[model samples]
Target: MLRFAPSPTGDMHTGNLRAAVFNYILAKQRNEKFLLRIEDTDTARNIEGKDKDIMFLLNLFGITWDNLVYQSHNFPRHRQLAEYLIQKGDAFYCYCTKEFLDQKRELAKANHQAFRYDDDWAELEKDKNPHPVVRLRAPKEQMGFHDAIKGDITFAPSEIDSFIILKEDGIPTYNFACAVDDMLYDIDFIVRGEDHVSNTPKQILIHQCLNYDKTMQFAHLPIILNEEGKKMSKRDNASSVQWLLDCGFLPQAIVNYLVLMGNKTPCEVFTLKECMEWFDITKIAKAPARFDIDKLKFLNREHFKRLNEQDLAVLLGYKDSAIGALAKLYLQEASTLNEIREKVDLIFAKKGLLLAQYKESAKTENAEILEFESQVKTLQDTLLTMLNQDCSKTEFDTFKSNAMQNSGLKGKAFFKPLRFLLTGLAHGPELSDLFPILRLYLKDIVRN
Candidate 1:
């Protein structure tokens, strides 16, 4: 089984959610289970109801972990493992006080060197302090592991301190709890952000001490950078899933865009099931991924094109069939739910079509009232006729030619004002694409 361990300290950021998605995809493709382990060992910082928020967000993206675990519930096991390491001498109790350590660190800094915990209690074999902490007995040489994306990553033991496995308060440190939790759960893979690369050595050391020279894979996903290439944070609107939901971005579009980021797949759009079928751990990019809002909007627009008219109507919250028919007229140009509603709402009440928006352009184009109005009327009538006749593209082409010839109008003078009448935009879906759907607006054109 694959497991995703997210700390419920705050709202679910896009980076953490992406990691959950990767693990979920891998497990689904393999027909195995994806497990959820909430790392809530730090109760001091825990916000009430944040765990539910995490689960809610997970389900929001359609991610369903097979097994749900609370790391705090496994605290006894975590402490038991730490004690096991101590009894085996793979870890030791340190009586080093915080003040003593700080003084040593400052002195080392002054001398232009790094402080190494020399296990000062080792030679003396004396319990010199009131509060003692558990520390791992790390190797003096290099510790190396194979990362799915980065290949081989090696860290010198000195580069890692003989960090605390269990705190003075008898609580397991994050690394200790995380490693033990994964092992206890028998997770087949550990997928997380590359920022946690430094923690791997410590976890692996703990794993080795437990005699679990694990075959479990470690896949460190790339970081998601902001527009400025800085790491994404709460300050970046794009990093918040809640922000996207509130803005009405389709969940499928978000999933599609996220899967494409740092993914080797050339595809720009996919359903969740399709993504599961195509996900490959080794194909994830080693480089950090940048979060581009424009890409997301593009995907959203692509999804808009695939929506059925009725579904589009429901999304726009329109109950009237007339508005429903017109709602789809805007689908081809709309990239968001709000945009679709805005377009339909414009035509819903005739008062909104005030025609005032056309004043400047109409004056500039002479409103082409006499010359272009007749031509547009002809085109509109011809489109209505085509829709009634169920005509082909060839027939529409013939009508377009006749309208242009009869109007003695060509270029912007002809097309611009006509476009303004059909839709307010100067540039949009081609007139040809609009013809079949034009039947929806015929009565309005005649009355206006």
Candidate 2:
């Protein structure tokens, strides 16, 4: 079994989603059951409704799980396991006060040495303190595990201290709760970020103390870095999955880009289902992956182009295939749906001629601004007349011909004003092409 255990914190980070993608793909590839474990034991830090938000994001990306479990629901099991360790002499109650431990930690820091809890406090009588935390009696022997991605990792006994299992408030710490639950759920395969490498040895100690013999496979993916080569954080707007979706990135494209990062893939672009056919967790690189927005944009555009015309139109807030085709024309210049939508909206919006800009350019060329305005008026009048007569039969070439003849202007002088009056832009796709697709709306275009 494979499990994705995410805490109910704030917005889901891209790095976290990447881990989920890997776990989901690996489970499908091996035909194993995938589980979603919401690690909400740390209630103090969890946000309300964030768990639902996480599930929604996972569903949006098509990452399905076979089982759903919340860590908080297993509090009784966690406490039961802690008590078992204490009764078996593998753990003991530590009656050390907070101030005393703080002093010891400070002294260790002053001596430039790492702090390891001394078991002297465990010898205190149980009646001496009403509230005490349970600490595992860590073995002073080397602990090691073979990671699928990092391979053969070992931790010295000194690095594995007698960490707390259950707090004075009866709350299980992360490692304790996670190890017990993994054992209970029979999760054989674990895939998570490399930040959890330090906690692996502690959890290994927990499993050993409990005498759980089942071997658990682990793969710790490398960290994702920002453009500045530092660890990506939530502060970066692009680090959040919701932010990426709001920016018009397709869910499939996001998955494709994430799976392609620091890993070898069969091709540049593929859906989650296609990726499942060939994904190999062991083949992923140990080096950190960099989040490249430009690469994601490229992949998003590729995925966008694969959509059918009607579907694309619906995404752009339209139901007409011609509008979809018109939007596709801007694909050469725009990389996202929002960008293309803006371009299409401009076609229907009232013309916003840059009169100040045109006047400035006219002054630079020693030409009359009034002459330019007069030519624009002439073209508008002629086009409106043509539309009034027979809007359906008006061809772009013939329309331009009549406008140039009536305005007594030619080339850029005539075409520039006409283009601005129609599309409100100095330059864009050829009018001959744009006009035909926009024929249905010619009356509105010319009159407005």
Candidate 3:
């Protein structure tokens, strides 16, 4: 079995989806059981309706699961196992009071030393410290494990202390509940972010002490950071999936982009079916990846290209063929649908300026401007003729050929003035493409 478990503390972010995507892909590849497990054991932080948000995110990304499980549902089982460990001497109860523990921790911090729980609490009388918490009795030897992405990793046992399993509040700690649940469910493999790599050996110790008959495979993904190379928290996104959707990003684009973050190849566009067929866990790198928002928009544009013209226009909320074709020119390079809409909207404004004041930064000299106007004068008749004619999808080349031949000014010298006059931007959706739409108001521009 394979599982995609996320803590329902908040909306599912891109990093969370990456973990879920990997697990779902691997489960499909191996023809194994797959499940959605909500690790809602941390009830204090678990937001209401967040689980549904996670499901919505998974559905949007086209990752499905056969079963759904919540860590909170296994409270009885977790407590039972903790007791079982106590009986087997693999774990013991700590009778230290909250005050004593806090004092100990504060004393350690005061002296600039790490706090490790004293085992003397285990020997304390149960009558005096009745509300004790159960803790794992860590072994003294070094531990190591094979990770699918990280390769062989080793850790010194000295670094681990007697960590709590069952808290005084009767809830099992995340590590304990996770190990117990995976074992009980007979999970085949586990896929999680590399931040949890430190917790693996402790789980390994628990499994060994329980005398588990089989071992499961593990794959740890590298950390995904914000574009600035800092940790990507919920603060970076408005509300995770909703933010992306509001930005006019297609779900398929997001799924494709996330998978390629850690993957070896640059296959930026993929469907959910395609990902299931081609995604390989071993190819994921251990090095961290920065979440480049620009790249997401770039991939979105690529996916948008595959849409038919009608479908493309419908998505952009435009019905006019001239505008649709004009938008397609812009969409060809737009990273997001919003970019196309914003530019198109500006060009279609009724009262806005048509001829942009060329920025001093454009370094456009008065002599060069006059030269361009003189050259363009030769093509006024040809351009007016084009305005009267119908333009097919391939008509951009026809327009380009006539303009180049008549004015004898190709590339930037020819296109920049037209683009500036029409769209007020140095670069935009193809000029030939924008011209057909611009022809609707060409008298205004040509008259100016």
Candidate 4:
């Protein structure tokens, strides 16, 4: 059995949601029990309604946990274990404050010393008046293990931090709580993000102290990065999973994309069932993958193209509305939504229609496409004259050569007004195409 433990601290970020999806897939693959455990140990950071949102999001992806548990309910178990470790000399109390630790760490960093928890004060007895935090008795020997994915990782005792297992506030720390909960849940496999690699030695030490099974297999998946090769943070637009949903991404497409983060497979696309059948622990890549928004967009667009209009509506959560109306307006009657949506997107660029399409065959036409046709040509002639006056022939030619070359403009000084003249939208299809379309419409209008 496996359990997904997510802290109710913030909105579901990309990394966190990916971990959930991975766990769900793995559990389903092996026909094992999967559970959801809310590790809300840090009471100060817990956000309201986030836990519910997590459940809602998981349900959206068709992942339902076998059991649901909260760490707050298991505080006594953690404390009992911590006390037992203290009695066995596997843990001790520390009276050091945050200020003392920060100064020591800074000095150690300056001196090139291992700026980790030294446990120099590990031998200190429990402070009677003011309660002391319990520290894990880190072994003074090399601690290492072979990761299912990363493989053959070694960490010397010097690298290990004698971290706190229990805080002075009498609440058990993450290391102690996780260790106790894992045992209680009888978790067979521990698959999580790579950030926890450094914390593994301590977790193993806790397991050893409890005399629990220490042979559990482990896989630490890679970190997600931004386009700049830096870690993708919450501040990044693409970092939140909800942002992708609001932008019209299908949930299945997202799950499919995330599974390939540290995963290796010959085939490009795989369904959940296919992923389960082909998922190999040994095949996961050791290096982290940068989250490519373009690749994600491409994957999403492919899925969008594949869906029938009805299914697409359901995926987009527009199931109750007039799907056939939309299909007729944007899919059937028209060659593509990419065309009308291109026009509508200007009202939103790039973002397509939100409302359902409806039939309007009986509607009377006020102005013909011709009326807008000559207006478009007149606008272009005015634009050309303005461009010649504003810029040198070389610059004008550079801008005219390709619409993409317009990235040279810092602002919308070039494209903004032109879009207004064309479609009353800020941006749309290529300027070159628009000019020609307008010319054709104008010729028809002049003939009429």
TM-scores for all candidates?
0.77, 0.91, 0.77, 0.73
Residue 142 accuracy (lDDT) in model 1: 94
List model 1 lDDT by residue over 1-448, tens digit each. 8988888888888888888888898888778888999998897988888889999988978999778988899888888888899899889888777777888899899999978777764324235676688899877779988999999999987788778888888889999999898788788788899989999989888888899965878899888999899988889998988888777688778888888897888477887778777688899888889998878888987776666766766777865455555655565667677776766555433322434445445666564555555555555454444445433334436655655666566776567655655554556666676655543554454224
lDDT of 2 by residue, 1-448 (tens): 8889999978899989999999898888778999999998887899999999999999999988999999999999999999999999988888887877888899999999999888876755456667999999876889888998999999988887788999988989999999998999988888999999988888988998889989899999999999888899988888999999998888999999999988888799999999888898998899998889999999998887888878889999988988887877777778888888888876676653455566666666444667777777777777777676765667888777877887777997898878877776677888887887787877766554
Q: Give the C-alpha miss distance for residue 443 in model 1, angstroms.
A: 11
**TM-score of candidate 2 on Cα atoms, chains taken together:** 0.91
Model 4, range 396-415, lDDT digits (tens) per residue? Answer: 23544433243233234445
lDDT of each: 0.76, 0.85, 0.77, 0.68
Higher-lDDT candidate of 3 and 4:
3
| Candidate 2 displacement at residue 435 in angstroms | 3.4
Best by TM-score: 2
Tens digit of lDDT per residue, candidate 3, span 155-261? 88777878899998889999999998899888979999898999998888888878885778899988888877887777887227678988889888888888888
How far in Å is the alpha carbon of 124 misplaced in model 1?
9.7
Cα RMSD to native, each candidate?
6.1, 3.0, 5.8, 12.3
Q: Which candidate tops lDDT?
A: 2
TM-score of 1: 0.77
| Candidate with better lDDT, 1 vs 4 | 1
Cα deviation in Å at residue 107, candidate 4?
3.5
